[model samples]
Target: MDQPQNNPKAYWRENLRYLILLLTLWFLVSFGAGILFKEELNAIKIGGFGLGFWFAQQGAIYVFVVLIFVYVRLMNKLDRKYGYDEEA
Candidate 1:
């Protein structure tokens, strides 16, 4: 006999911590390190661009892409752990 699928809501509930962590990182890089602390970070530059500006522009985008991949990987792990994944 097959086990019933875990509730979708339970999966989301269990995964909420991951969402919060990713959001915190997103906030730190985009707001804290980019806008709020721009002046302090101006001492650093990359290819003639201010560190804050880089973060606000290219850096944040790169982080976002990485975050997407991370989320995918983590969700795969989480799904397996919760027995909601098709792979297992």
Candidate 2:
């Protein structure tokens, strides 16, 4: 049996850290590229459409899906590191 390295508070802090990081990335991709930096990204073209337009319409969704998988994988690793992983 594995024992956790830190107390509940520490565990939660780490969890929140991961959440914040992942959510920040999602927000940056969805909003930053889609809206804030749209003009700059618009200078680039992808498949006959502006890069920012693509990001707003489709790229953000793809990034979000990828982020979901990334978050899950990262959390699984964190859980294992902290001895919170489920028994297989």
Candidate 3:
């Protein structure tokens, strides 16, 4: 039988990077683009959707959903690499 191998440090680092990136994006869209820069973004509008309005209403949600999926994907890959993914 082959023994499973795992690198805790690598796993933690990858997870941390993924989380940080996701949080940064969340902060940027939720706070930066939605509130802080609302006035500046107001100067630009796409069709009937204003920049801040679009970001607050749809873009942020979309990005959040995508980020979750991306995290799941990366975690799955990491698990596989570390022999921790049962589904893999």
Maximum-lDDT candidate: 2
Residue-level lDDT of model 3, residues 11-52, one tens digit each, is 788789989988898889988888888888877897777898
Model 1, 10-83: lDDT tens digits are: 78886898999998998899888779988887789889988988888778888988998999999998787678
| Model 1: residue 31 alpha-carbon error in angstroms | 0.9
Off by over 4 Å in 3: 1-4
Q: Ranking by lDDT, best first?
A: 2, 1, 3
What's the TM-score of each model vs. the native? 0.83, 0.87, 0.81
> Which segments of model 1 are wrong by more than 4 Å?
1-10
Best by TM-score: 2
Of candidates 2 and 1, the better by TM-score: 2
Reference-based lDDT, each prediction = 0.84, 0.88, 0.83
Question: Which residue pairs in candidate 2 have backbone atoms (N, alpha carbon, C) closer than 3 angstroms, thus clashing?
Answer: none
| Candidate 3 lDDT score relative to the true structure | 0.83
